[model samples]
Target: MSSIKEKLSKPFASLVAKRIEKWARNPEKTQQKVFRNLINSATDTSFGKDHNFKKISTYEEFKSNVPIRDYEDLRPYVERVVNGEDNVLWKGKPLYFAKTSGTTSGAKYIPITKESMPTHVKAARNAILMYIHETGNTQFVDGKMIFLQGSPILEENNGIKLGRLSGIVAHYVPKYLQKNRMPSFETNCIEDWETKVEAIIDETLREDMTIISGIPSWVQMYFEKLIERTDKKVGEIFKNFSLFIFGGVNYEPYRAKFENLIGRKVDSIELYPASEGFFAFQDKQDEKGMLLQLKSGIFYEFVEADKFYDENPERITIKDVKLEVNYVMIISSTAGLWAYNIGDTVQFTSLKPYRVIVSGRIKHFISAFGEHVIGKEVEQAFNEATENTSITVNEFTVAPQINPNNGLPYHEWFIEFENLPENEAKFIKDLDNSLQQQNSYYYDLIAGKVLQPLKLTKIKKDGFQNYMKSIGKLGGQNKIPRLSNDRKIADKLYELQLTK
Candidate 1:
């Protein structure tokens, strides 16, 4: 059964790919028009009876007239609908809510309508297609694909149904092909989150996986578990795996360790996925890769990062955004979110059709210490430091911790070292210097005493895995906090580091 599905999926995906390729040729215009049409249709269906639906003539009109909404603003509407209220957001009855765990926020219940289900599946398929194109590996159509996703079961009035997204995809995937898959779901669904992860690790270890996909931090943790579970190394267990598809977090910090674990130079595919929608994916051919996507289904807006929410925020349509300028992204998707700030920052890498790189999150910036350090900035600093010092970091986390004695703040770095050269102090100095040069706020904090000098703490090899274990978040979908804005978590982590 799975073999038959694999054979069919190839041609079906190929047909989708050809259409996508044609659309990518003139994506900016194509996407803009498609966005407009979807918005118009949805608006017509939503308000057509009460009053005539207003047609937006220009991008400016769409940007200025349509009020921007955040997730919090939609909470009331979402909650009402979830509790059985009829609403415009749900064209048909909503099947279920896709519960997602956030960084600072505990959990978010995103309303998932029947219409939105296709977008999730399409996005997953797009991710696979992007992976194939980048690596020039056509075998993926024939090979088993693994999606390291959240659990597939949902708690409901009539017991737990399939997770809104995961369950739907699982149901639709050709059963013959199902045997080639692994999920963090299964019987572990009823277990405590901690025990569930251990069960997931146990199950994932049994597969002879060809492709592995998940959040990078979580994937790394799984590898650590594999090390503990068996005498075989990660390279031995995943010897058949050819590609690693990662999203949801930056992978630069763990790239070296991941490569070492895999035992070969494995290709990586990056994706931009959120509860709202899977917005963009890396192009297969480019070095950094181009971001291509379903332009017609979603409208995109960009506001300059520095100018976000200004008195007159300078806004650009997908067509107008320039290469290399970091901008906060806004999306008007089929989910009935209009002019919504998705909390992600992106920069265009090419303009012929429009390709982009996910820089970081708007909320992920470090500004409490006055260092306006974004993810890209940190990535640059890390790369420069790594190149200069020749020290490879397995995993790292940065946070601002208030000093208990002085009530002052300081930037703390928790790093897992693979090999520290004899001149460790010199290496730390060089890395610090590189950060100061790359980030002015970091320089100010060090020089003007806004914060204490940067401090580095080395952990035992695979220290991050142990940290995750100690927190009872050892595997599956959980991730180590990469950057902490609050002091409570940071302080606790600091104490953990001290004891280590």
Candidate 2:
């Protein structure tokens, strides 16, 4: 039966691939349609009327009327919806509120309208379908798949279901995969992530688990658990497991460690999903970035990352985006988030197909002395330094040491090493040099004596895990920042550092 179903999926995948390629090639026209549709759909809503959505016919008009807003900015309209008001942002009350933990605000409730929810399910499905079409390897469809995520259980608030985005997505998995998916509903519903993972191990331990998807850190724990039980690499246990899907954080820093855990390199898909909307996904195995979903209900606007805080900085659409330029992605979507700043910074790697690599977060970076070092640069630098070497990284983060005890202030890297480097001094030098090469400001800072070479503090094994546990964020979607402007994370990490 699985074989028959697998055969059917290929043709369906091909059709979807062709459809995706159609919009991908006509990016400008595609976005314009989404833009018009969004404006038309919400023109009757409170936000639309207040923002002059009826009079907005052109991008310039829309841009002029709507100011870019973050979660807090949209909270007024969202609060109305949360309090059971209908048509507050969208056409009517949303189907769900993707409840996410906010930095300042206690909990952020991003509305998931009936019109917007399908896109989340479709984008994830399409990501895998496109993979099948491009790779011509759909055999994994016959095997059990697992997406390590939050509980499928949801809470009701004012007639709307509310939960983490992953949890919300869990309820929508296709019926065909009900039998093919791993970790039974009971196990998945376990609230404690550590306990849930253990339950998953007990359930999936001798099963044909062929597809494993999750955040890398949490998945690492699962892999470690499996290894502990059987003393075997993940690949050896799940002989047919091929596809690894992940999002939320870059996978490069964890690549070496994963390779060690799995015993071999396997194919993986990267997705750009948020509580706001499902944005992009890896459509090709060889591509440098995920293909931006232009034809999706979300209309995208890009603001130059460095100029994001400037007085009325230009917000350009997809047509104006250039290669390698870091952009803060803005969206007016069916989810009724108008000019919403998703906070992710991305760099376009391919213009023709609109492929983008998530570079960093807008609020996440190190600019202590004006050397604005980003997450991508640091990850690249570390990956470059450790490439083909024995030093495997478990987890890592960067922050500025503004007032060091010694010579000069420098960037401090907190890394949990799976295997310590053979020559620690050279590793540090290579890592610092690579960062300098990637970010010109960092290079100038070193040359101008503004900052010393970056310093590395080796964290004890499972130190990052312990830190997360201490904060009650040990698992499920909580990612360590790659770089921070402040020492909040650095100070905490220092407390977890291995004694020299």
Candidate 3:
């Protein structure tokens, strides 16, 4: 059965590849069609009437009438929908609301209309399918695949279900593939991440797992539990495991740790998905970036990252994007998000294929003293620092330490160790040196004495986890902020340090 499924996946994935290629070849036309379809689908709704969606035929016209908005801007319509108002945002009330963390707001309830489910869920499946098509590694479909997901049980918000995006996606896993899914339904619904992982360990211990997917940090925790229970390397426990899929966070810092934990090298794929929509995925092994999902029920725009905080930043469409320019991503998707700033920054790596590398979040940066440092640069520094040393960071976050009262400002890193480097000072030095090499602005700040060198703050074992648990956020789809310009998270970590 596995061999037969493998053979069938090749042809099906080939068709998806062809469609994606065709869409990439003429993005402008494809985007226009997507826009038209969206307009037609929502024309009778209240938002459509207010925006005069019926008369909008061209991109310029659409832009002229519809203003750019973020989550706050759309909250009114979402609130109306939450009150059981139909045809408020889209044609009808959303099927589900994907609950995600908001930067300033407590939590954002992003509408997940039936129309938008394909973009969020099917695009993920297509990512794997395309990977298989490119690599001819159909054997990945031969055995059980473990997806560490949020609990599927949802909370009712008015008439709509509200839950994590992963939980919503899990509900749509094809029936044909259910047999190959790991961690029984009861284990998956455990609510607490630690307890769920423990149940998963017992349930999947002897299963023929071939693929595993989750956020890198949580997956590492799961791997540690597996190793503790079995006293065997992950490679030994799941000999057939071949592919590892990860998203929702940067994977570079965790790469060394994962390679060590698994006890062997294996294929890994990166995806860029948000509650709003699935944006991009790694399409080739040799590629340095992910292919943009241009035709996946979303129209994308980019604003120069440096100017994104400005009152009226320039919005550049797909046609105007330049290679290597860091831009904050804006999307108008079937999820009823119009020119919404998703708070993510990306740089185009290939214009021909429309591939982009996610640089960092708009809110996740250290820019004190005019030295703008994004997550990608920080991850690169960590990767470079650990390359020649035995240091393997299990978890880490950085924040700007402005006005330490006696000295210049510097980046303060809070890190938990899986393996400590022999020369800890050398590790810190290497990290600082690598950052200077990767980001010229940061280097200039150091050279000009505008900022002091970076400082490392060691976090004890499970410090991050304990903090999250204390705040009642120690569960699926939640992550510690990696970088911050403000002292909110830094102060909390310091408080946690006092307790430790």
| Structural similarity to truth (TM-score) of each candidate | 0.85, 0.98, 0.96
All models, RMSD in angstroms: 3.8, 1.1, 1.9
lDDT of each: 0.66, 0.90, 0.87
- The 10-residue segment of model 2 with minimum total lDDT is 491-500
lDDT tens per residue, model 2, 1-500: 45888889899999999999898888899999999999999999999999999899999999899999999899989999999998889998999999988877898999999999999999999999999999999889988999898888999988999998888998898999989987888888888878998899998889988899999999999999999999999999999989999998889888888989999999999998889988999988887999998877999999999999999999999889999999999998999999999999999999989999999999998898988788999999998999989988888898888877789899988888889999999999999999888888999989999889988887888888888887778787888888899988777877765644
RMSD of 3: 1.9
Model 3 TM-score is 0.96
The clash count of every prediction, one per candidate, is 5, 0, 0
Ten-residue region with minimum lDDT total, candidate 1: 44-53
Q: Estimate candidate 2's alpha-carbon lDDT, on a 0 to 1 scale.
A: 0.90
- lDDT assessment of candidate 3: 0.87
Model 2 clash pairs? Answer: none
- lDDT score at residue 243, model 3, on the 0-100 scale: 96
User: Compared to the true structure, candidate 2 yields what TM-score?
Assistant: 0.98
Candidate 1 on 271-335: residue-level lDDT in tens?
A: 77666777777666445644646463677778999789677787777667888888999877666
